[model samples]
Target: MLAFDISGSMLKIANDFLSTKASCNILLYQGDCTQLFPLRSNSLEGILSISVIQWLSEDSQIESFFKECYRCLQMNSTAVFQFYPNSPEHADQFVTVANTTGFHSYLIMDMPHKTPQ
Candidate 1:
């Protein structure tokens, strides 16, 4: 497994935690998710991000990030990102960008009762 974070401190904390409990060989790196990842095209089976995508404040950055994800993932693979959009328009932007980047996107609201802030 490969994991990365923009924060060196976060990576260190993850490394310290994973070293004791993780069963698999997990490689960790410190890098910006909005930039190109140190990976080859069509190399990854899947990608998962938790509360990360919303940090990209610009449309180009989001588009670039999605494009990079699409480039790295294998055909028919999925990249699931869990994030809280600031508003409905923000959520729509994510879906729109994902679709524009050649991904068949879906938005699954975990809590339908509570509206997005």
Candidate 2:
């Protein structure tokens, strides 16, 4: 699982995921998640980033990160991602980046409040 932002709730989710599932491997990193991806591995089956996309501060970087996410994933792979669509405009941009990334994705709602900057 590729958890972006590393926030408190996200950290709790990560901890739970780790404790409950011992069959998979997990790695942790600090900082922007978009730059943290594009991992080289044919073994990677999928990725996850919950309530993290909205924290993206730069539009260009988010787009680049989407590209990286596409590259890191293998064929038939998936990324269960989510984020708060604070405004219609912000939502549009996020959707645009994900759509243009050349990866199969879906818009998941029920996102929490925005992270404090």
Candidate 3:
């Protein structure tokens, strides 16, 4: 099963991804991902998010989002989130927010990619 949030061009990108993958249940959220309510608590094993959370600019919203994420995950579950930081400071802020919400801080990998045009 997969949970995805999409709007605009991302919806199309996600559609393209789904077209090539093995069949699995997919839930697409069209609005703000911060409003999502995860169903079947502790049921999801691997959660992946990419280049999304960077859009949130306010501390309160980030706090709420992290709280929700923590609530939605089961013990020992892993979430891999990749986001583009506005700057070094922004990256630090992201870490502070994630750790405050109870994630064990780990910088898994950092790679370079040209920003999409």
In candidate 1, what are the lDDT values of residues 12-114, reduced to their tens digit? 9989998898485889999988889899999999999888898999999999999999999999888998999988889999999999999999998877457
Provide the global lDDT of candidate 2 against the true structure. 0.70
Model 2 Cα displacement at 114 (Å)?
13
Q: Tens digit of lDDT per residue, candidate 3, span 40-117? A: 656667668788779889988777777677777899988877888877778788789989998875655476446778
For residue 23, model 1's alpha carbon misses the true position, in angstroms, by 3.4
Residue-pair clashes per prediction, in order, are 0, 0, 0
Task: Give the alpha carbon lDDT tens digit for every residue of 7-63 in model 2.
Answer: 567667776878787686666545556665536844468777666677786988888
User: How much does candidate 3 score in TM-score?
Assistant: 0.76
Worst 10 residues of 2 by lDDT: 104-113
lDDT of all predictions, in order shown?
0.90, 0.70, 0.74
Clashing pairs in 2: none
Evaluate model 2: give its TM-score.
0.66
Model 1 TM-score (2 dp):
0.92
Residue runs of model 1 more than 4 Å from their true location after superposition: 112-117
Score residue 107 of candidate 2 by CA lDDT: 58
Off by over 4 Å in 3: 6-9, 16-22, 108-117
Give the Å shift of residue 110 in candidate 2.
4.0
